[model samples]
Target: MNPPVPLAKLLPVPKDLTGRLALAGGGLFLGQWFLGDLLHVPGGGLGVLLTGAGVWWLSRGSTPPRFQEPASLQGWIARCREVLDQFETLEPDGGVRRQQLDAVVQRSGPQRLALVCVDPATCPQQGELEQALAGAAPLTLSVARPLASAEGARTWPTVLQEQELILFSLAAPLLAEDLLWIQQLPEDQPTWLLVRSTAGESDRHCSESLLAQLPARWVDRVLVQRPDGLLRDVLQPLRRQLGAPIRNLQDTRQRLLRGLHQQWQADLEQVRRRRFQALQQRTQWIVAASVLASPLPSLDLLAVAVANGLMLREMGTLWGTDLQPDVLREAAGQLARAALAQGVVEWSSQMLLGLAKLDGGSWLVAGTMQAISAAYLTRVVGRSMADWLALNAGVDALDLERLKREAPVLVAKAAEQERLDWGGFMKQSQQWLLHATS
Candidate 1:
């Protein structure tokens, strides 16, 4: 969901002319201060023009108009095909042994359970595991001896192939690495957690917290250890599950594939988000340099609009999306309007001007303030666009009104998030200011 900030409250224009005048006034002063000499007299008029243009655009923003999606029926069909291709890429069996999946489907016999110990301890030993499974008749229990070690992870999977279920038996204090490693495992393979947590919390309580890092399914078949080195399964859950009258081996295969798909989705999202952050930093710098070279905020913001189109196109490529280029520009326009309405430029001018009022702020320039704020705007716009793509990924088509409706929240959220990183922004901007002014 987008932020709770209301769309109606976030108007595209400033509430009063006074705010614009104040912002323009600040820029006007900075403009004359930075451009001095005999020409300084006419520089005031130049400042008025620059200030008015910026204030006009900021308060009364305009965006590119929305375009109809997919030029023709064939284009729409092609998009559907692309969506299908992306869906196939998300298949769980991706990057794994296809033959192994087939082997899992063909084999059938006594239900098997592959046991793994995440946290290894020599106390309970293999003898204790066999004793625990003694009552589980018509079941094969293959404990991965010294699990997590090179010898165990190598041979464990083939010995694992015969099994329909896995029991992760943690016999010591759980560490962060256990969670990281488990993330790579299959999601749909029938799972059971056997945790030997230390004293304090009750078995059930400990079970919940212990498997918190894992999927909720891990908690379902949880078998917590007692002080006597026996599982506290009052219902004989393990024995009953293994000795059940019937089983669906195909369903087990489906579960394995299902888990694979889920893992693929998670992995894909992580990769895209990382790329987005990198792109944001790169684009922000590009926009900031343009803003610095051309001190007119309106022209610099126009440059930002062009940059957004390219950013949105790259973002679409990242997500395997097929929104038309025109539609992306239209989306960029909507975001630009929302961003300008947020009044980041005027706010930045005020803040920078306020800093200059202090005794030590001797090096501040009008161009410096405008350049940094433009960079800040790029950050906000890029973050908002990324969220837009994430929220609407895999949709059948683009909805312009939907993007417009979502704009307020997306822009508001991005601005709020960027504010948290203000110190970093200031530090970087100060370095840029010193180099540029020097």
Candidate 2:
């Protein structure tokens, strides 16, 4: 069954202004305050013009208009088709086989393959991988096994010799040590390190240190996670749709005047602002939800969600769109409901088990949140979240508390030892989330 959509979750139309003379006087005074006191300007003429325009626009139209794209129906349809094609390539069992190195070679162009080993016995697809690449033309494959000669050591240079590319498809768990070795290796060739990550497995919380160690140059092409197998087919189209801005949001005056049979540029701009804000809110929600791999209580997940939300909201504001608060609230509620219904609790338990292997401290939780937060929040929003956290949750304004809380849970603990810091960390994170997005 489709999840229930609550009426309270709907975006609301703006209310009409009443008490004309009083309202006008108040607006005039507020305009002066913004221009003279806040902005430190001489007179309020510019403020008056802007304020009057805004009010006039809002008063005529109760809600912001919807955004439209620049393309016509045929153009948009073609774009959608293109997105579908790219998405199909990532699907599991989608005719693309790991044993068929030929497909990868063909797609990436005629280049030599860089092969690195993590001991065949410990490698996940050692035999199958070798067979696949052997037949592909114009490729030089080199192999090197991790040495047992030293305590916890692997010979890095042996793999670099005669190879123009490097591949890491190891069976062993990816760790910071392995990543550091890869980073230290000669960078003459473009490297393709394959791992078992997909969009669905992001929250598994495996070796993030490896992600942090990614060479700055290759960040864009790096496959952080695979697209969702189930949604892979639709992923590109979805991405395109989300990326496109709504047309009405960009030209509200035109949209509003079209309905009223007037040609007022002032009214059109106001309408544009409202629609833009709505677009921002929706985009924010989509980005956050797209990254989720079964929801967790960890601050990291929430931070990502909030960052996406904030970015969307800001984008809309810049375009003169007014984001509907109710839509945001409703979308959030839907997501929360979906997670609860889908047995996300079990998923969180599994993720926690995986994260427990990382050795870290009290600041880990906060640090994770900071990373996710930074991904979405621009300077303005980041400072706002930080300040809100400090004021409301009694958290350090610097966001260092994440480690104090989550790290201990990840620490090795005896069966009989109960965790105390766990509860406090969760509370702090929840508090910050509420304030940051509310």
Which predicted model would earn the best TM-score?
A: 1
Provide the lowest-lDDT 10-residue window in model 1: 34-43
Model number with the top lDDT? 1
Residue range 112-172, candidate 1, lDDT tens digits: 7776765566224566666666766666667675445464342235445346777766643
| lDDT (Cα, tens digit) per residue for candidate 2, span 1-438 | 244232112312223345434434444554454334432334436546554443233223222223343234343333333322322432333533222322212233233344554545433344544554443344434455553336765555642433334565533256656666665654534455554453435523423634555667554323333333332231233223223223212222222222222222233334444544455334433433333332322322334445545653554334222346433333232233232223232233333334535645432242333332222322222222222222222111222233223212222121112123334434543454454456
Provide TM-scores for the models. 0.48, 0.22
Which stretch of 10 consecutive residues in model 2 shows the poorest summed lDDT? Answer: 409-418
TM-score of 2: 0.22
Per-residue error for 430 in candidate 1, Å, reads 2.0
Give the distance in Å from residue 100's predicted Cα in candidate 1 to where it truly belongs. Answer: 9.3
Question: Any idea what lDDT model 2 has?
Answer: 0.36
Clashes of 1: 2
Alpha-carbon runs more than 4 Å astray in model 1: 1-259, 295-298, 395-400, 435-438
Report lDDT per candidate: 0.60, 0.36
Residue 58 of model 2: what lDDT? Answer: 24
Pairs that collide, model 1: 92-260, 92-261
